[model samples]
Target: MVKFRNAAAAFKALNGLICVYKPACVPIQQIQHTILTNLCRDLNVLPDRPHEKRVEIVGPTNAPMTVKLVPNYADNPLVCGPRYIKEDFRCSWATHLGLFTSGVLLLGINQGTKLTYLINTARLTRAYKIHGQLGKATDTYFWNGKTVEKSTYGHVTREKIDKVVAHMQAAHQKTMFEMSGVHMESQTMFDLAAQGLIRPANNNLPVIYGIKCVYFNSPNITLEIQAINEYDKYLWTIIHDLGVQLKTSAHCTGVQCIRQGKFDLDIALLRKHWQLEYIIDNMDQCRRLMEEHSLILQPKSAILSV
Candidate 1:
C-alpha cells in the first residue's frame, strides 16, 4: 500500500521535533527551518545549504521513501512530503532522540501501510464495476478491524549502530506488506486538467501496485517476494482480461543473509509494467541491510550488486 512506503523517515522525525518543541507558527517554512536547524542537527550532522542541494529521502535502494508529513495544520489532499532526507531517518535519528521520534516515523508511513491497503480495497469494492479486470487481493480486506491494543504500533525497531550509546533500534516487524490490483477510478480525474491522456496524473488507471519493505525488519525476502509475485500475476491477469499484448517478468536482489550470518542480499528490481518501467529500489537500504549481515565479514555487496 502507498501508506507504508515511508520512503525516508524524515517526515516522522519532523513531526516529533514540531510537537515536542511546540514551534511558533506551524507554518511550512517555519517547520522546515525548525527541522533543518534544530531537530536534524541534534540527531545527525545537517547538510550545509540544505535548501540548495536536492534533499531526497531515500531507501536502501535509492527509491523515494514516502513519509507522511503529518500536518500541524492543513488537510487539503491530505498531502505528505516525500523524500526530504535519506531513508531510515528513524533508524538514524531515533537512535538519538528516543521513542517519540520513532513514533513520528512510524505514524507517517510504515504504520499507515495497513490502513492504506484497507481504504484502497474498500474503494475498489464499491468501484468494482468491471469484474475479472482486477486481482482477487483487491477484493479481500485484511482489516478484521477488531482492534486490540497490541495492534496499535508498527513493528518495534532498534537503532543498533554498533556504537555503545547508539545501540537503539526500531523493531520493524509490525508493518504489513500487501499487493493490490485496485482499479483506481481516476479516469474522471484524468479526463480533467491540462495534460492530455498521455499519462494520468492521478494514476487512477488499473495498476498492479505492490508494497514491499513495509516491514523493513522482516528477515525473509521469500515472503516479500511472494507478495510481489502475487501482484505481478494479478497484473498479468488484468492485462490478459483487457487483451493487451505485453511481456512480463520479475527481478530482485538484496543482502541474502542473516544479521548473525555471512551473506548479505545485494539486489535491485526493474520490470516492464505494461511497457512502462517501474522500479522499487532500496539500493542504499540494501546496502545498510547488507551492512548488518556483514558484521560477519565478507560483506555481500562486495561480492555482488554493489
Candidate 2:
C-alpha cells in the first residue's frame, strides 16, 4: 500500500486505477464529477484568495480568531509552480452502463489513464442478472421503450427460451443476420426500432461472440455474455427480439477482464466495492499495447515521497 504524510501528498500519490460502484439512477459523468469534487476537498486544492478571511472558533480560554486559511498563490510564485497543486487528474473510463443499469465502472487516475484504451478495446465479458418476462413486444426494442404492444405473449417456456438463446449464441458470428424479421445492423438498431418498424426486414446487430446461460426461470434469466463489439442496445435487442417481456430493467452483476492472455482481474471486487473496483493487473502490458501512449504526469518531487 502507498502512504503519504498529508492530503496533498496523498493526492499526488493517487496515480493508480480504482473502480467505483455506480447505482441505478446516477449518470456516469455525475459519478466522475462527484469523485473529483470530493478528492479536491480532501486535497485542499481549492483556489485561495489572499483577501478572504474566515471566522475560526478558538478554545474556551482563547478569543475567536479570524484567519486567512490558504496562502495567496499570486503573491507566492512557488505556490503557483509545480507544487502540491493540480486543476484535475487525467481521468478516463473503460466502459459505460445505462442510467438505470447498475454495474462496475473502471476508473483510471493519472498514469492509469493510459490503460483505458486497452481495457476498452479488449475482449472483456460482462455478466448480467436480468429480471425479465417473456411474450411482450415493445416498439423501442426495450421493455421500457414506449410499450408499443403490451401483453404480446401469453406464456413462455424454458425450452423456447433455450432455443432462442442457442440461436443467438450461434448467430454471434453472423454480421448480417435476421432474427424473425428484424435486421441486426451494428449502428442503426436503435434508430430502426425508434422508427416503429413492425416486423422489419433487417436492422443492425451488435456482435455477440459468446453467451453462457447461468440460470433460466420463466420470466428471469442470468446470463454471462461476451461480445467483441459493444452497444447498449445490443443486449436489449436480443431479449426483446426473442419475444421476452421485461419485468424489471437489467443490471450487470459482474465483469471479467481478459487482458494480454489470461484473466487479469477478480470479479469478486464488484460485490466487495458495491459496483466499482480499481484494476492494476497488467498495467504495463496495456500501456505497451496502446498505439498512442502519452502520460502527462507531474514530477515526483511535487508530492511528498515519504
Candidate 3:
C-alpha cells in the first residue's frame, strides 16, 4: 500500500467506491495512494481526486475483495467528433504509459465503420505521487452502474452523442474537445473501451443531464471485467485457460531472448518500493537492478563503445 503524505492532493473521485467483500475493511489509506502515485509516475500523468466513498461486496464464501473506485479525468477519451470523421481518433490508456500490447479496446475511438466504446477486460485506474505522496489507484473507470457526468437524452443512438457534445460545450464552457477515428494498425485495449451503450443517467428527470466525473466513476474498466459480464462464457473459459499458460515462462526469461535474462534481483524491493518488477532486460534498465543486487549488468548487444 502507498501513502500520500500530503493530505491535500486531489485525484479523480466520481462513481468511486472502496469495495470490501468481507466485513473487514481494507486499510485503504496506503494502497489507495500507492496505486494512484505509481500509475502517475509510470505514465507521467497527473489527476485530481474528488469526493471519496467506499462500497462493500460480500462473497457467498465469506471472502472479500476491496475494489476501490477512483476517477481519472481524461483530456482524451480516444475519440473526437464532428470534423474527425475521416481519420482515426482515440484515447488509449496503455499507449500513453508506453505499454507494449495489442488487441486493446480504447475507451472511445472511431472505427471508420462505427464508433464504439468498450469497457472491457483491462485495468482502468491510475494513481500518482502528487507533490511526492504515493497515492493508491482507485480503478472504477467503467460504464457500470457507477455514476458519471451523463444525460438521459435517448437510447444508444447517434443522437446520444449529439447531446453529449452540447452538454460538454455548456459544462466546459467551450467546444474544448472532439473525437474522430483511431490510429495504429493493430487490435488494442484503447479501442475496446469505447463499445457500449449510453443512456440518460436518470429516467424520471428529463432535463437531468447526467454528468459524473469520468475518473473514479464506477467499475474500473479492465480486460478481466469485460469477459465476466459481456463476452461468452465458453469463450472466457478457453481464453482464461490459454492466457494462464502463456503468462508464465514467457519471453521475459533471458533464455528466450538471450539479451534479456532473469536477474537475482531484490524482487521484494521492486514490488515494495517501486511497484515494478526488476527483470534485467538491458544495461539501461538493469543499472539500478545490478546496483541493488551487487551485480554488474553487461550489454547483450556487443556493439563496442566507440
Question: 1-306, model 1: which lDDT tens digit per residue?
Answer: 112223233334232111112111232233224334333333333222122223344456566575443324222222433223334333111101111111111111233234233322322211001111111122211112222222111222222112211211111111111111222245533332223112112323332222122222321111111111122223223322221111111112111111111111122221111010111122233335435644224311100010
Number of clashing pairs per prediction, in order? 34, 17, 87
Candidate 3 per-residue C-alpha lDDT over 1-306 given as tens digits, one digit per residue, 9 for 90 to 100: 223322223121111111111111222233334433453443223333233444544445567655554433232333221211212222222111111111211111112112111111221222111010011111121111133222221222223323443453354311111111222333532342233312222222111112222222111111111111111222222222222222211011000000111221222122243321111112223345435644223322111111
List model 2 lDDT by residue over 106-168, tens digit each.
667787776566565443445454444454456655555555555534245566666767877
- TM-score for each model: 0.16, 0.56, 0.15
lDDT of 3 at 198: 20
lDDT of each: 0.22, 0.48, 0.22
lDDT of 2: 0.48
TM-score ranking from best candidate downward: 2, 1, 3
What stretches of model 1 exceed 4 Å from their correct place? 1-114, 117-231, 238-306
Candidate 3 local accuracy as lDDT? 0.22
